[model samples]
Target: MQIAIDGPAGAGKSTIAKMIAADYGIIYLDTGAMYRCIAHRVLLQGDDFSDTEKIIKLAQEAEIRFEGEKVFCNGEDVTESIRTPLVSLHTSDVACIKEVRELLVAQQKKIAGDQSVIMDGRDIGSVVLPEAEYKFFLDADVTERAIRRKKELDAKGIEKELASIKQEIQQRDDNDRNRVEGPLVQVEDAIVVDTTGKSIDEVCAAIKKYIDEVRA
Candidate 1:
């Protein structure tokens, strides 16, 4: 009963995933947060994102855990820590490393193997959960995505310019799509949902209806 949701940043992957998982009484795994946990670890040590060995070593020893909506790394709660803009910037660097992806992907597979899980990430459908019973690709206009991100940060009282946020998201898209290890891609069988002007509930309903119709 595993479900995979893949998408670029700010496409409402996490929010919608959590909703669907809750509706189905399944575990929702935020796979991007796993990579961000490793990035946060490296940033805590230094700003050398280019050091592949250091990043891989940090990843090798990392213990990422998910308890409901919170993320824990090495027994420490990093739910809020890993969501920082800084960690978001460096997450791609860690995710690009071959060894790091293998380690995290194995953990992701193991988690799914243990239960019926709903996982979301850039590469989940393509790599981590290729055999998932359901796969969805959510996408939206880049500007719309950036606006969503700005609202999130603003709600958190973290100020950031919209233009800069848009640029940062663009960079993330490029990196995610171009990365060699586990690139962001829409699998052929994945149901594509354009969320450019849709509300979260709208998208969720659309997905549920699609899945339910097929199952029926």
Candidate 2:
């Protein structure tokens, strides 16, 4: 079985997807990191983020892999490097490119390859895994999502004003929703989970309940 979890930034898709995959003994794929890996490469080369052609080429040529929580790009461990704010901003831009999306989506699908997997990303349900046996769309209010993102950054010792982070997140939402290639959207068959004010375990349990019902 394949499970697809789609959500905007800081909506707990990654955390919940990891939990679900672990509990069910399946592989977990973080599709966002693939884009971030390409962004990281672009930044390393000092290439302009707006250079779509270069970004697409970088994405296609780069080798991306994930093992547990560690991410590797071109055989280099970039688990922490790709999470920088700069890469986060550029990731949205790279992900919006049509060629970049196509390249990464193909790679993501190849990694699943008949295995039971749980994948999470902005467009997983809508594009990458439309036929997934289980699909979920997680969401939270802007304020709540911002708070979650801030906490994550704080843990990494990356400090930014709450208002600034909130604005960036809102901008990301706009970009994801309006992107031409595989725009972020909640497909009709997906289970929409409003994660505002909910704990991670609560959200995981709710999704697991649905999965259990299906299995039953």
Candidate 3:
């Protein structure tokens, strides 16, 4: 059984997907991190982010491996490196490219094939795993999602202005929604979950309820 959770930035899809995967005793896949891993490599090489060809080469040539929650790129541990604010900002540009999406989406599908996995990303429901046994579209308003991002960064000691974070989030949304291939959109049968005012447990319960209904 595969579950695809689609959401914009900071909509809690990653957190919820990890939790749901743990509860259901399945592997969890974070497709966004795959792009971030490539971005981290590009940045490490001091390559320009807007150079789509370089980015695609880096993505295709780089060795990205996920061991449980840790991510390794090019045999180097980058689980923590890719989560930086710099990587977050640059990855959006890399991810919006058609070639990058095609390469990574193919790899994502291969990783989740024949596994009981819970995957989360902007295009999971619409592209990466459209035939997943269960699917969800998670969303929250901009301001609310920005606040959540601020809190997360603060916890990591990454000082960032809320306004700047909000602006970056908007830019990411625009880039993802307007991308030529596999743009972010809800799958037809996915249940939309507004996560603005919901607790983690509540969201998990709602998803569990949906899973139960689907399996019934």
All candidates' TM-scores? 0.98, 0.98, 0.96
Worst 10-residue stretch by lDDT in candidate 3? Answer: 47-56
lDDT digits (tens) for residues 165-209 of candidate 1? 999999999999999999999999999999999999999999999
Q: Following a full C-alpha superposition, what root-mean-square deviation does model 3 have from the true structure?
A: 1.1
**Highest lDDT among the candidates is held by which one?**
1
State candidate 2's TM-score.
0.98
- In candidate 1, the residue pairs with backbone N, CA or C atoms under 3 Å apart (3 or more residues apart, or in different chains) clash, namely none
Model 2 error, position 149 (Å): 0.9
lDDT of 3 by residue, 150-216 (tens): 9989998999999999999998888878887778898889999999999999999999998988788
* Candidate 1 Cα errors over 4 Å, as ranges: none
- lDDT for model 1: 0.93
Give me the overall lDDT of model 3.
Answer: 0.89
Order by TM-score, highest first = 1, 2, 3
**Candidate 3 residue-wise lDDT at 105:** 92
For model 2, residues 76-99, the per-residue Cα lDDT tens digits are 999999988788877888888888
In candidate 2, stretches whose alpha carbon ends up further than 4 angstroms from where it belongs are none
- What's each prediction's clash count? 0, 0, 0
